[model samples]
Target: MSALLRAEGVGKAYTLRGKRVDILRDVDLAVRGGEVTALVGHSGSGKTTLLHILGLLTPPDSGRVFVADTDTSGLADGALADLRRTRLGFVFQSYNLLPQHSALRNVVLPYTGRGADGERHARALLDRVGLAERAHHLPSELSGGEQQRVALARALINDPPVVLADEPTGNLDTRSEETLLGLFRELADEGRAVLLVTHNPAVSEAADRVHRLDAGALVAEGSAA
Candidate 1:
């Protein structure tokens, strides 16, 4: 199957101390449905930058980003925002939940649909993430794993086909990380494309395909053996 999200010859650079430093150069990647693609790179290797661009939160200095067949480079910020709301999901290392909100509330916060149906879906998602009993708990009452799971459920509120995760397991223990990976696999199995950025070997091993980056360039890529 073809990728639902794609980046072609993408490049980005920043000026630091009057010197130009390339964060990414000529990077090409494809995230297809039913697969988890892991981007593995060292610090400063531009993994997060590439993810931001792919998520439409940032634009590349050169090249183009494609969502299905639509070129997103020329899109205005409002268009990009609209596309992001409907077509993408995001998971972050910090979980990004509101401290004052219940798990159910946090999950339902992203829903752009009707409140009644959104609550029902949010409840179902909390159950799916193994947090149904804790649905009323606030972020302060949840463990890191539980909070991350809450964040995961929130990401699905819009039923986005593409999910982007950045260091999602960086704060979790081994057991939590394993559980999260299992959930990710299930998501892909359900026909969503998952693009994950990580520095963890276990995370990379769990992916269907792994991409490695170095010094602003894609260095290697392969399927898990």
Candidate 2:
């Protein structure tokens, strides 16, 4: 499979109290369609920073990021925003749902210009995630797993080819984590490029490929299954 999101020799650093602190160094990786790629590391290892770069939320200080064949280094803020909205899906550990909105409404929020069938499509996605019956429930009324599933549905609202998830199973119980693990695999089966940053061993262990990072650099990588 080819990469939908590719990072090559990427590096990032931040200044703290007049001292440069590197967060990533000469990193190289790809998140390809039809696979679940897990990035694992301890806290402060820069896994989330790398994910942010790949997701176009942050720019690398060195090297390049490619969305499909498009080199992102030269794109302006507007172009980058367009690409991010149209080409990528994101899931977060906090679920990121609007507190007052119904699950159906939250799922449909990103489908700008929804036209006549937006709610229908959103309903279908909710059903796909096994939440059809709870479509009208507020985030406060749902379980953590349910809210995350709703976030997953929302992420798909734009029909993005690439999915980026940061610590997706971080807050779930074992059973819920397993359920999400299965869903991630099914996402691969449906041909979306799935890149997830996770600390949970179970989450990484279930992935098709695993990459390990240490002190902001890739230390090891291999097939996990």
Cα lDDT of all candidates, in order?
0.95, 0.93
- In model 2, the worst 10-residue window by lDDT is 109-118
Can you write out model 1's per-residue Cα lDDT over 126-146, one digit (the tens) per residue? 999999999999899999999
RMSD, candidate 2, Å: 0.9
Every candidate's CA RMSD: 0.8, 0.9
Q: How many pairs of residues collide in each model? A: 0, 0
Highest TM-score: which candidate? Answer: 1
- Candidate 1 achieves a global lDDT of 0.95
TM-score of each model, in listed order: 0.98, 0.98
Candidate 2: list runs displaced more than 4 Å. none
